[model samples]
Target: MERKYLYLDYLTCIGCETCETVCDFIHDGSPHIRIYVTENKQYLPINCKHCDDAPCVRVCPTHAIYRDEDGAVRIHEDKCIGCLACLQVCPYGVPFYSLKVRAITKCDMCADRREEGLEPACALMCPAEAIQYGPLVMVLELVNERRAKNIPEHRRELGEEELRKSVSSGYVLL
Candidate 1:
């Protein structure tokens, strides 16, 4: 069965990269995070999206990637062949080759934390209230609200060609 998945809010993010740092701190006790922050003009922190139809699940040759009942993708490190095939096909680009493990690793959505009914480490540690973990409907509603607030008034709505674009980017495994 498919349940809700975690995601991030790029607009609320201040590009502090705290999410990345926090994940690293919790997982490795170092400054190395699975998630990365890419900031040019906007503060976009890149992380595993845990997609509805994850490519990683499909592309794993050893069947290392599998979805739980709640639709969370988990990597079976033991089953991984370390062929880097998942890295090639993942649209979100979450999987990566970990030299330490000699296998692929990606965001598990803080599975241990979730088991305790807590939010993902990065989501809980977001100081800006940027990262939200909830149902898709709720998040989309929040995004729409933010868009309404950000757009200027006294400007006549333009055609489809004039619609402003939202922050758009995906993860990249490296």
Candidate 2:
């Protein structure tokens, strides 16, 4: 299966946070996507990068965190022992101990929704279309369309390096 990707353009994001609300509603109150405000006052959308070599998958001693058939990094709730290994290793800080589920939970890119032929709530609900979900090439084209518009020069390019430069780009997760 061709891997689908989710991308965000910070420039077009109006910071309305409808994504967070929809995510919570869909996921039984545990939001997998978070919107953070940087020191520069930009709305930084943080979710799982689901890296090619996922550190969380490597560090999980219990094998609870693993990549699914669709290539999304997922936590097997039944196998999780609350070791906090995945939490420590994830660069985006996407995983968190959910008191409700009693396990480390992160985004699965709305897998259940996908099974029913729906895109992720965040990307679908984003009013400005800042968040995009589709084939990587198509998404990247959409990203490049807004390349130099209303963006700070340093962050004008947030391609595949989005995860790597997140912190240095002045996004502080609160």
Q: Write the per-residue lDDT of candidate 2 for residues 1-174, one digit (tens) a residue.
A: 677777777756778888888998988777888888989877677889778899999999999988766667888999999989888988888888978789998889898988898888899889989888887888888877556342454355554376356645544222
Off by over 4 Å in 1: 29-43, 152-174
lDDT (0 to 1) per candidate: 0.69, 0.79
lDDT of 1 by residue, 23-110 (tens): 8777875332344434555556676777877787887778998886666788898999899888788766667778888778777777
RMSD in angstroms, candidate 2? 7.2
Model 1: lowest-lDDT 10 consecutive positions: 165-174
Name model 2 segments beyond 4 Å from true.
39-41, 148-174
Which residue pairs in candidate 1 have backbone atoms (N, alpha carbon, C) closer than 3 angstroms, thus clashing?
none
CA lDDT, candidate 2, residue 104: 90
Taking all chains together, the TM-score of candidate 1 against the true structure is 0.76
lDDT of 2: 0.79
**TM-score to native of every candidate shown:** 0.76, 0.78
